[model samples]
Target chain A: MPDSFDNVSVSTKANVYFDGKVVSHSLILADGRKKSLGVIFPGEYHFGTADPEVMEITAGACEVVIDGTTETRAVAAGSSFTVAANSGFTIRVTDSPCEYICSFGTP
Target chain B: MPDSFDNVSVSTKANVYFDGKVVSHSLILADGRKKSLGVIFPGEYHFGTADPEVMEITAGACEVVIDGTTETRAVAAGSSFTVAANSGFTIRVTDSPCEYICSFGTP
Candidate 1:
C-alpha cells in the first residue's frame, strides 16, 4: 500500500473543465495544504493557474510547453515539472490519457 | 470548481499492485472511510476486496463480472457497481485505460 493518509477527507467533482476532457478531485489535508488529482484526455490544452504548481505525472505521456519556454519537454509516467504562479502551460496529450497530482504551494 | 475538501489530507502510494497494470493511491477521509483511486491498463484483471466495494468508473470503459453472476455488465464513465465483502470480481479492460474510485464500506 502507498503512504496511507488514514486521517483526512476528500471530495471529487464530476466532469470538470469546459472541454469535458478533464476531471479533478480535491484532497484536503489536516495541515491545510491543497492539492488535486486530475485526469486529462488526449488533445492539446492550455491551462493557467494562479498558484505555483508542481505537476507530477502519475500515468501516461504528454508534451508540455511551459510559459516563456521555447522548447517542449516530453514527460511520461513518474516524471514531474513546475510552473510559476500566475503563469500557464500547454499540454499536448498525443499518446494516452494523463493522470496527475497537482500540488499548490503556499504563497 | 469541483467539491473542495480544503480541510482534509490525503497520501498517495506510487506503483501499487503486482501486475504493474494497476496503480492505486490512498485517500483518507476525516470520517475514517477507506477508499482508493485506481488506474487500470488494458487487460483482464481479477480483484478480491476485503470489504464491500463500490467501484466508480471515472474514466474509460470496461466490462465487469461480479462474482456469482452469470452475465457481465458494461460500464462506462460516470457508472458504478458494487461487489460484496470478502468476495472477488473480474474486470475486462478492452477499450481504454480505466480510472476508478473504489470506496470500501465498514464491515
Candidate 2:
C-alpha cells in the first residue's frame, strides 16, 4: 500500500462517530476520488455504504462481517475488504484501535 | 479559518496518543510544510513540541495552558493557540470531543 498520497485536498475538520470512538479525516485524491483515514477504538461498529467501498486496514486488526454474510473474517494490517454499493458491514476491534483507509466509489 | 486545504500530501496511518485519547492524521502542504488534523476526546493531555505549532480548533472547544504557564484559557471553535518551539502545552476537553488542525514550524 502507498504510505501517503500526494497532490490531494484534505479537510481540516474530523468526521466523528460514536462519540469520538471512531474518528476520521476526509480527503480527496487528485483524480477526485474521495477517501477517509479512520481509527476505530476497541468496540463493534456497523457502517452502511452508499457507493461501493473498499476498507483497507492500515494498522492493527479487525474482524468484519459483511451485510448478509455469516462468516466473520479477521483482517490484519495491509489487508482489505470490499462491500457492495448500498450495502453495509459490521466490524469489531478487540484490544487496540484498528486503523483503516476507506475508499468510496470503488468499483 | 480555511475549511480545507488543496494540493497537499496526506498519510493514511494515524498518530495515536494517550492510548487513543488523541488521534491525528499527518499531512504536508504543497510547499512541504508539515501539519496534522486531530481529534481530542474528553480528557486532559500534555504535549511537547519540537517546533512552534499553531493549533486551530475547527470544531468543539478546549482549555489550554502552555508549558511553564499557570493560566488556562478557554479556546472555542474557530480559535487557536500557539506553542513555542521546544516548549509544550496542556489541553483539556470537558464534555465533547475537540477537533483541531496543528500547523508545525510556524513563525
Candidate 3:
C-alpha cells in the first residue's frame, strides 16, 4: 500500500515559521499585508474567544487560554491544536519559539 | 487596517494542482505509496460519508458525490470543499480533472 495519500493536487502553497517575538512567511492579503499570522510570546497571556477559531501549538513550552479559561498545557514540537471553528483564545510561550500551522479556508 | 489577517505562521506546507486527469505533488507517507489518492473520472460518481472527512474541489468543470447522495454541483477553479471530518464518499469528474486538496493531520 502507498504510504501517503495520492490523486490530489495543490497549487500555490507556502510554509512559515515563527520565532519567539518574531513571525515570518506570513500569509499576505491583496493589499500585501500580513494576513492571519501567528505570534510567539515569551509567556502565556489571556486570549478571549472570538470568531474564526484560533489554532495554537507550542514549538517549545507554553500555556494557552481557551474560551476564557486558562490552562498550562505542555506543548511539544509537532503538537497541534484545532481551535473550534470561530472560537477565541490566547497563548503564551516560554523557553523557545512557539511554532504552529495557522491556515484559513477559502474566502 | 491590513487587508488580511495577521499574527500567524505556517511551516512546511505544499500546494497541488490537477489537470482534469492527472495528479501531481501528492502527499507521500512513510511507505512511499500513494495513500488515499483522489481519482478523476469522466463524470461524477457516488461518495459515501466516512470518517476523516474528504475535501474536494473542481479545477475545471465537474460533478461530485457527497454522503451517498448524487448531486450535480458546479465546481470551479479555486473553489474548495471541506469534507466533514471522517466522512466517506466517491466522486466522479467529468470534462476535466477533478482537483482538490487532501491533507491529513499529524499522526
Candidate 4:
C-alpha cells in the first residue's frame, strides 16, 4: 500500500459523519478513481455503500461484520475488507482510532 | 476559495486530535506547500503551532481567540484566521461541526 498518493485532486472540505466521530477527505486519483482517507474513532459505526467498496486499514484496528454475515473479523493495520454493492457493514474500533483508505466503485 | 486542489499529494493516514474530536488529512500542493483538511466537532480546542498558519473555514463556523489576545472572532464559511509563529489559538465550535483548510508555514 502507498503511504501517500501523488498527482491527485483533493477536496478542501471534509466528509463528516456521526458528529465527527468519523471524518474523511475525498480525492480523485490520476486514473479518475475516487477514494477517501478517513479516521474512525473508538466506536461502532454502520455504513451503507452505493457501490462496491474496498476499505484498507492504514492504522489501528477494527472489528467488522459484513451484512448477511455472522462472523466478526478482527482487522488490523495493513489489512482490507470488501463490501458488496448496495450492502453495508458494521465496524467497531477499540483502544484507539482506526485510519483507512476507502476505494469506491469496485472491489 | 477553491473547493478542491488539483495536482497534489495526500497522506492516506489522518491526524486525530482530542481523542478524535478533531480530525485532519494532510496534503501537499503542487508548489510544495503543506495544508490540511479537517473537521472540528462541537468543542473547544487549543493548539500550539511552530509555524504561522492560515485557517480557512470551508463549512460551518467557529470562534477563535489567538494567543495573548482577548478578542474572540467569529469565523464562518469563507472566512479565515491567521495565527503567528510560536503561538497558538483556541477554537470553539458550537451547534455544529466546523470544517477548515489549514495552511502551514506562512500567513
Candidate 5:
C-alpha cells in the first residue's frame, strides 16, 4: 500500500476519528476552474477558511450546524452541496464520520 | 465534526498510512453511470477486487507496480488512469502516499 507521488509535495493533514474534537489544516484553494477537494468521514470537519465558495459532497447521512443553526440534512451518497465561505459550521455524526467530499476555490 | 449520512450504511474500511504495508477493503462497485470512487494519499493502496475496469485519478505523481512489473509513471495532478481488473499491483512510495482517486464498475 506504499505509494508515493512525485513533484507534488506531501502536505501535513490530519484526520481525527473521534467525537467532540476539533482539528484544523491549512489548504491552498484551487482556482475557480480547478477542483480542490478531499473527503471527511463522520466526526470530522474539513474547513477552508480562506475560500469564499466551499462545497461538500455528502457520502453518507449526517447533521450539519451552519452558522449557529442546526439542521438535519440527508445528503444522499454521491450528492453535492455548497457552503458559503466564512460560514463556520459544526457537523455531529449520528453514525460515524459520514463519508463526504469537499472542494474550495482558491483566492 | 461528527456527521452521519442517511440510507447509506457506514461500512468498515481500513487505511494504513505507511510504506510497504498492505491493507484491503471490500467495496460494492457502482454502475457504469454512477461514479464510485474515493481518495488515497501516498503510501497507501485503493484496490477494487471484484470489478474488471478500475480507474484511478492521480492526485500526485507516483510510481505504480502493475502485476509483477514495476514502472515509474508521473501521474500529474488531476489526471486519471484505468487499471484492468485482476491485475494486482504493489505501489512503493518514493515520496509518500501519492494522492489519487479510484472507481470501479459493478459486475
Candidate 6:
C-alpha cells in the first residue's frame, strides 16, 4: 500500500525541542488537521498535549511512561500508542534515534 | 548550534514515493515555503524537481548524479546538495537507509 498522507503540503519551519534533541517538521493540511513529523535523539523527555495524540514509531524503539502508569512500555518501530488530550507522557530513548509522527486529534 | 528551520509547521499528509521506498511528510510553513522530510531506503531512484531543491542528508548517506554530472557524488550525514528548478537527478543508496530533508526554493 501507499504511504499515509501523501497528498498534503508541508511547511518550511521545523519544530525543535529539548535543546535540539527532538526535531520535527510541522504540517497543516488542507482540511486544517495539524501534525508533526520528527526525530528524537537518544534521551529522556516529558511532554504534555493539548489535543489527543497518536504517536507512531516510524523508526527505532523507545520506552514510554504515560499518565497513571508507573511502569514503562516498550514501543518499537511500526508500532503506535495513543495519549488522551490534556494528559502527559514521558519517553525514554535508550539507543538509536527514534523517528515518529505525532498526529493530533480533537479532544 | 541548532537545526535549521526549527519552528515551522507541517501538514498532516505524507509524501510517499517509489512504492514506499521513499516516504516523507510534507510541511507548509507560516511563511508559505514548502519542504518534505523523509527517508529513502537503500536503492537507486530517479527524480525530477519543479523547483530548486536543497537536499540535506540528515542521517545516513547516499550518492547523487545531478543533471549536469554523470559521476555520482558521496553525500554523508550532515552534508547536502542542490538541484536547480525543473532539473532531474539520479540517486543511488548503496548501504543503509538515507534520511533527508528536501527544501524547495524559488525558480
DockQ values of all predictions? 0.26, 0.92, 0.02, 0.91, 0.03, 0.09
DockQ of candidate 5, scored on C-alphas against the true complex (2 decimals): 0.03
Stronger candidate by TM-score (1 vs 2): 2
Least well predicted 10-residue stretch by lDDT in candidate 1 chain B: B1-10
Whole-model Cα lDDT of every candidate shown, in order = 0.71, 0.93, 0.40, 0.92, 0.39, 0.74
Model 4's lDDT to the true fold? 0.92
Candidate 6 chain B, run of 10 with poorest lDDT? B1-10
Candidate 5, residue A49: Cα displacement in angstroms equals 10
lDDT of 2 by residue, A1-107 (tens): 78998898999889999877899999999899999999999999899999999999999999999999999999999999999999999999997899999999954
Off by over 4 Å in 6: A1-4, B1-106
TM-score of 4: 0.96
Compute each candidate's TM-score over C-alphas.
Answer: 0.58, 0.98, 0.32, 0.96, 0.39, 0.55
Interface RMSD of candidate 2, in Å, is 0.7
Error of 3 at A35 (Å): 8.1
Please report the candidate that would top DockQ against the real structure: 2
Off by over 4 Å in 4: none
> What digit string (tens of lDDT, one per residue) describes model 6 on residues B1-107?
12444445544434556755666766555577877777777789999988999898887789999987788899998889999999989988877567788879961
Better of 5 and 6 by TM-score: 6
Which candidate number would show the highest TM-score if scored against the true structure?
2
- Decreasing lDDT order of the candidates: 2, 4, 6, 1, 3, 5
- Between candidates 4 and 5, name the one with more favorable DockQ: 4
Per-residue accuracy of model 3 over B10-70 as CA lDDT, tens digit each: 2232221222122223344344422132334365454444434435452444545556456
lDDT of 4 by residue, B1-107 (tens): 78999999998888888888888889999999999999988999999989899999999999999999999999999999999999999999996889899999964
For model 4, how does the per-residue alpha-carbon lDDT over A1-107 read when each residue is reduced to its tens digit?
78999999998878888877788899999999999999888889999988899999999999999999999999999999999999999999987889999999964
Q: Write the per-residue lDDT of candidate 5 for residues A1-107, one digit (tens) a residue.
A: 11211111112223322221322122221222322223344464534344554444434455655664557555655554556666666555555334443445542
